[model samples]
Target: MRLLIADDHALILDMLQNFLEQEKDMEIVAANDMQDAISAVSAQPGFDLALLDYDMPGMDKLDGLRRFMENNSAPPVVILSGHAARDVAQRAVSMGARGFLPKSMPAQSLLHAIRFMALGEKYVPVDFLFSSDQADASPAPDGPSATALTARELDVLKALCDGKTNKEIARDLGLREPTIKLHVKTLYRRLGASNRTQAVMIARSWGIY
Candidate 1:
């Protein structure tokens, strides 16, 4: 498969390129930032897949999807991030990315996720599949206050905790993106989370997710 990888880190770029080169059927097109990735995708043709870093200098987050969409190339983009929160993963998938893989995942798992995504499959972290009952088994200190979110809000927050974007959260919950965005703002205020990562960290610490 013809593959492109965009990451700001040289070591990661080189390592991934070298590793994928050993596969014999893959070709590497490299980019160090979101802009470079976008340019590479636009200039080059017939890329079977792309691996994008969410925190690349130019992209910094979910912005790469806007550029990808603007370029009109949907080559099964996979978001690879160092701080792969549930909200980011969900958001990447929602923004039309083919898959989401954490940078911390094992190399084999990353490869497996990429290969599976290439075939139009979805992947979720095993840790995220647990039921809320299990997740919230620890009793809330003040009962409702500790678990204050309404069921829908909690659902939205869980998706956020999973690194899902507002659009993705909307899709997953069958709500409008605007509505999800509202929920997210409310969640941020309620949880004192300034960003998705912070919200997730706070929730985990509070045993809310």
Candidate 2:
């Protein structure tokens, strides 16, 4: 896989580059800031993925992600941050970021997340997605907010967003298929959505993905 990773911190760039390059068939290029990242994309032109630091120079919060998406026929973009809030991560996903990766996350998980996003799956850590400080998240949902949804319901919502079938979600969550069905029913009612697509759309609007 080809990747473009940009951050202002040299140590982070080195660490990521060195670690990721150790895997076979992985090619990585690094840039120091958002402008440099854009320039690198312009020069290279067809990276498979791009990891952008959330607060680097020229990254006026999510404006940089918006600009990057607008500027290039870009690959999937994931935000890399050390301390971005839950609401910020949710907004990033809402703005079309493939995922958000906390700097403190385990490197193995980071690799998995990168691959997951590269494969067209959306990603955000569960804790980050369901954090306590969600003041910036979308206005409270009409039917049920995150507070009203159980953790298992949240998992079902995310699986729906992933386009997983009830059986598939059941297997992944280690629940019986009938139990998964029950969760789906609850998710639909609580999300005020009548169908899977509608439920996913509502969830995305609430930053659930």
Candidate 3:
């Protein structure tokens, strides 16, 4: 398989390069940032897959993933994110990423994800895909439900999921901090979360991000 790997950290880039190089059938192209990744992919066509980082400096994950798909729709994309949340993983999958793996996972797991995603199968932690409903016998939904938040609230929630502070979110969405706070308060009440971290976790389960 010919793969394009994009990440910002030099150490990680080297580690991945070394590890994947061991696979005699795999040819790897590496890039340090979003722009470099874009150029590399464009310059080297017919890549079988792309292993992308969700949070890279100046790289918009969704946008970059879309661009990559626009060019190469046959080969699936797999996302590697340091941020661990079901919602982010779901979002990446919804956006055409065949697999989503957290950086905290072992290298073997990463290899497994790559192998599975190359086959056009979904890869997510099993726990994230199943929920127990012991009392009702009905299986819980795949993740948290987004029905609790309004359209605007969802926009707010999405910004929050990206690790943006309230002030930063307000500026990005062209709203006042007070307005953002009001929405946050309402979101917390709806999700039954008392803090930003909790809210993010719940929202992630619901795939709101």
Backbone clash count for every predicted candidate, in the order shown: 15, 0, 3
| Model 1, span 1-209: residue lDDT tens | 88999898999889999988888778899998888887887788678888888888877578757677567664778888776556667777888787777677778756655665565545544333222433333333342243456576678878977888888887887867766666666567567678889878877877867
| Candidate 3 least-lDDT 10 residues | 128-137
Model 2 TM-score is: 0.66
Query: What TM-score number comes out for model 3?
Result: 0.58
Over 31-94, each residue of candidate 2 has an lDDT whose tens digit, in order, gives 9998898888888888989999998999999999999998655778999998888878878989
Residue 192 local lDDT, model 1: 65
Where does model 3 exceed 4 Å of error? 72-74, 128-209
- Model 1, C-alpha of 25: deviation from truth (Å): 0.9
Q: Looking at candidate 1, what is the lDDT of residue 158?
A: 83
Ranking by lDDT: 2, 3, 1
* Candidate 1 residue runs with Cα over 4 Å from true position: 128-209
For every candidate in turn, the CA RMSD to the true structure comes to: 12.9, 9.5, 16.8
TM-scores for every candidate against the unseen true structure:
0.60, 0.66, 0.58
Candidate 1: count of backbone clashes, pairs at least 3 residues apart or interchain: 15
lDDT of each: 0.72, 0.82, 0.72
Clashes of 2: 0
